[model samples]
Target: MALVHHDPQDGILITRIGQAEITVRPEPPASASGAPVILLRVDAPMLDTLAAAYLDPDEARRLAQALVHAAEAVRPATPWRSPRPNTR
Candidate 1:
């Protein structure tokens, strides 16, 4: 969970994934009031070939909306909560 790149101007934060390190960067909104975009990139060091997949703002929002609806549709009657931490 290390930060590989942080572009303040573009408002991009690229974080190192796991051992293989598939980068995940969330791009800032196209406009001030627009939704954010998500970018998944594979570096040459790991993949031997560079690749990238971008989820545009519109698509990202649509996916998120659908996910929320799906969750709501399949939600259980019992609400889920985190367990309390054990104090020594």
Candidate 2:
């Protein structure tokens, strides 16, 4: 599980994944609408691996889109519910 923390003092968002923790500062207001301002801090090794895995930008985008679709498909629609009794 990942932990997310919002700091009002610094206006920074911190996300802790496993043992790794990263802080991102949001961009100043007045940019494009609904654009993500914060940037995630990733180590060089991890960045290199990610780059190598998807050498082509187009392929990477395709893979990411596919992953999102697959993730949505596997997610449960709602909380587990027992089946209703069958009518005669």
- Judged by TM-score, which candidate is best? 1
- Highest lDDT, which number? 1
TM-score of 1: 0.38
| Candidate 1 global Cα RMSD | 10.5
Candidates in order have lDDT scores of 0.69, 0.53
Candidate 1 C-alpha lDDT tens digits along 1-88: 6777888766566666554455656867878998777886766555567788789867767866897767766883458644658987
Model 1: weakest 10-residue lDDT segment is: 16-25
**Per-candidate count of clashing residue pairs (backbone under 3 Å):** 0, 0
Q: After TM-score superposition, what is the CA distance of residue 69 in candidate 2 from its true location, in Å? A: 4.7
Candidate 2 structure quality by residue, lDDT tens digits, 4-23: 88878876666666555655
RMSD of each: 10.5, 9.6
lDDT of 1: 0.69
